[model samples]
Target: MQAAEWRESIRNKKILVLGLAKTGVSVVKHLQALGAIVTVNDFKPLDENKEAQSLIDENNARVVAGSHPVSLLDEDFAFMVKNPGIPYTNPMVVRALEIGLPVYTDVELADKMTDATIIGITGSNGKTTTTSLVGEMLSHASNLEGQSFVGGNIGIPSLDIASQASEADRLILELSSFQLMGASEFKPHIAAITNIYGAHLDYHGSMEEYISAKWRITANQTSEDYLILNADQKSVFGERQTNATIVPFSSTSQQIDGAWYDQATEKFMWHEEVVLDRRDLLLPGNHNVENMLVTMAVGKLLGVSNEDIKAGLAQFHGVKHRLQFVAEIDGRRFYNDSKATNNDATITALDSFMGPNDRVVWLAGGLDRGNTIDELGAHMDKVHAMVLSGESAEKFQALGQAKGITAIAKAEWIEDAVQKALDLSNEGDIILLSPASASWDQYPNFENRGDRYIKAIEALANPDSL
Candidate 1:
């Protein structure tokens, strides 16, 4: 639908905005501006909902903030706009579904409100780095300068940028499984899945449900659209069924058609043409090389020159909290991979920096999401010591003991974990904070956990400063 038509359809319609999170606020503001009769609902009490109260005052919209009253559902509402974080099991959402009212996320609303070409990216890992790279590559391309907007799960909400985009613009979005779950008509012109692994099973309930949510990225895509995937990931390639043109990228195999990392030559190749040397990339690790391949494939499809792609990949560093270098103290290097919220992600982090003589003082453990750490057993030989914390610390200690890791210590907090890792590390050793679980047991999110880790490291480096 065109932007004007979407605006016309929402004028004066009774729309219910569920949850007053960041995305929820954006939805209420956008709908109100379009002449929709908006009613906001959130579980937080009115005294604690300053944002919702402000929105009500500014937009003149009705709000039921104290609780999710079922009486609100009795009103003849046209449809519901749900926050991505609000689960499908929410009582109000369940009621809305039973009544046959259409439920949507801000992502779907953004899709209907814009005519720009969309590039949707989703995966268990590497979504942020790939999304940021795509944004930078498009920015450097002389043809695409001032014509690309990158946002979604990476930070800025897509709904806030959709109205400002023109038909010639490119919307680069990093979509999460939660946002994708409520998406019905969000068909991106170019969609890609970095890779899928067992993650968010606590919310998704099963591995099958988690995989299905990721596949929704290409559900509405047609043959004219493009779907970039990791050819090395059997779970992604073997299970994918889509009408979109499949563009496979790999760091392991060269038999694929779209893009491949030629390990023999250490070059990134697209259709047998070498685009850039592996040594030129600023980002480290084989996983990052795979991310570059995905970005290069998208650039190639958009007619971006090989030179431009090489330049973008060379200049781009990486996103924070994913194998980020903290600081070197007393000959020991500290790296933060706090974004490793699952076993698969931690495995990738471990693979990134393990050598014959190197020793890693690994810090891990958090909200156990029911995924096993058996995969890390094969790589345990590289670890010098294990420092565990959070709710799953004891479980991790037992797992380490079973793998024959001799030096293991358990801490009650992240600060203590950092100190424990420091005590166990020797000169020339590496201390890595790659928690293979969620941080909800302590910090609100992974970013907060990573920031706390950085702060603790700084304090440890200067003991007398405090």
Candidate 2:
């Protein structure tokens, strides 16, 4: 759609901006600029909401704060632009859908406004890392015709970034299933599903629903577009759902048609050609190796040279909160992996430190989502001890007992958890905070949870401040 045509379509039309977060605020400003009559609706009270108050005071925009009353639909809105985090099961969203009003996340709006070639990435895990990898790779490439922009679920709201993007730019987005569920016509030139696992069951209701939402990244793509998938996922091969040409990546086999790790040569291979040496990568784990395979596929698909890809990979240590190394107090090395919000991520983190001498004092637990600890049992052999916390603490304690782990401690808060972990640990043991659950029980997001762990580590390092 032409930018002029898309803008004019919403002109003079009443649009509802649901949930006044960063994405909601950006959508409201863009809608207002497009001459649309925007009504910003948020569940936060008007006095408590700074974003809503700012819109009302500065731009004189219409807003309904405090509650998502179904009566808001009486305004005859053209469509509803919802915050990605707001589930469709939400009362207001359900009502909006029942009324046959079109609903979308900011992605759809961003896609309509920008002419940039969108490269969207989504999966159960590694979305942020792969998105950053592709973004970094493209940024280093001299062959690219224009600049690259990274946003979406990776912090920056896509609307403003899309608005600033020129036709020559590459918009690399790290999309969450929550965001993807609401995306309708948000097709990307290059769409990638890093891998799929059972996640967000509370929000999605079922594993099937969650996978369907993740696959929506390619809903509008045709044969012309590229869809990079994990070849390691045998189920994905059986469930081919996209028209886009599939580019598969794997950590197990080097013969994949897309990208793979050549064990014999000890190199990262794109199709058949080498991209980067495996030993050169500083990031730990086979999961990161899988991440690199996906990243290289994207870089190669964008016509980026192997040298440029290597340069980008070389510069990247790792993203914060994902297996980030903290201070080594005495002989105990602390690693913050507070971003592992699911069982699979925690499993990966546990498996990564399986050295004969590298015993793990695993710090875990957070918001309980009714997860069974059975799957985690197999990966706990290397975990010499466990420090549990949050809503899932008791559940994890059972796992600790079942596994016959020597040391199992529970703490009320993250700081206490860190101290408990330290108490359980001996010299040379790795203290890891790889909570296999979300942080919503005690913290707003994973970053906050990770930050708390880091702060606690600092406290342990400098006892004088205490």
Candidate 3:
């Protein structure tokens, strides 16, 4: 169906929007504009929810704040729009599903509203960085100017850009497992799973369920579409089944038909064609090399020139809050990797600085997402000292002790953790904030947590007395 027909179908339909997060608010506005009777339910009280208050004041729809009353599900609602963060275990959601009401996220709505060529990217680690690099590479492609829209889980609601996109445009989305769980018909022309590791188990309830959710990105794809896989990650390609054309990219395996790094010549090869040399990439880490390989493969499929691909890789510095350089003090380098909200991500960050001279004064810990810190034990030797913070601090400290890591300290807050890391660091040490947990314990999100870490570093650089 076309956009207009889809919009007309929802007219006068009763749509219950659960949660008042950014995506939920966008859904409310979009549905209201489509002439639907929108009712919003959020756990936050009206006084605490600015989004709810604004909608209530505007009289756009009925707003129920402070609680997700089960009675709301009793209403004659046609379907429900859910915020990704609201798990299926929520009483209202569970009841809604029990009653046969279809659930949808903003991603599904975006897909229904546009005919754009969507390129969906997802994984445990590297989603943001790979998505950002794909966007940059496409932006530099002369043929794709004014024809690429980038957003989704990377901080922008896809619905915000879906309406503006045309059939000629390409929508690049950074999809999360939560968003994918509620998606049904949201298929991309090109879908890429950067690499999967155990993550979001608290919300997903199990590793199998988490992997299943990640695989949903390709559920709607067909043979005409392309599904990118990580050949280096054996688990990623082991048991996965997809109808879409599988394009495997690897940092180690040169035998792959898709993109692969040729270690012998220090070049990136795309099916026997040399795309670019490794030395041209500005981003650090082998994980980043894997990301670039995926980006280059996607670019090649889109007919992007080798020159544009090389230029884009050279120009892109990496995403904020993902191993971003904050500042240097007394020859000690600090990096903000607040986006490392899982053990796998923190492990990747730890591996990034594993050289003989690279000693990391690691700052980690945050909201425990029901995952053990034991996986991080393998990388603890790289860390000279660990200054932990937030709800998982004590747990991480215990894990560090078990791993035989000396100089472990726990701080009440991120600022104190930064100071503690600074105190333990010597010249040439790397201070990294790669929390292997979520940020809900002390901040709204990872970006806010990273901003606070950056601010704390700035304050230390120019003390009040100075």
Tens digit of per-residue lDDT, candidate 2, span 376-424 = 8998888889999999999998888998986888899999999998999
- 1 versus 3: better lDDT goes to: 3
Question: How would you encode candidate 3's per-residue C-alpha lDDT over 389-441 as one tens digit per residue?
Answer: 88888898998788777899888888888899999999989999999899999
| Rank order (by lDDT, best first) | 3, 2, 1
Cα RMSD to the true fold for all candidates: 4.9, 4.9, 5.2
User: How much is 315 displaced in model 1, in angstroms?
Assistant: 2.4
Per model, state how many residue pairs clash: 0, 0, 0
Clash-forming residue pairs, model 1 = none
Error of 1 at 400 (Å): 12
Worst 10 residues of 2 by lDDT: 232-241
Q: Kindly list the per-residue Cα lDDT of model 1 for residues 304-366, writing each as its tens digit.
A: 998889888887756789887778799988888999898877888788766556789999999
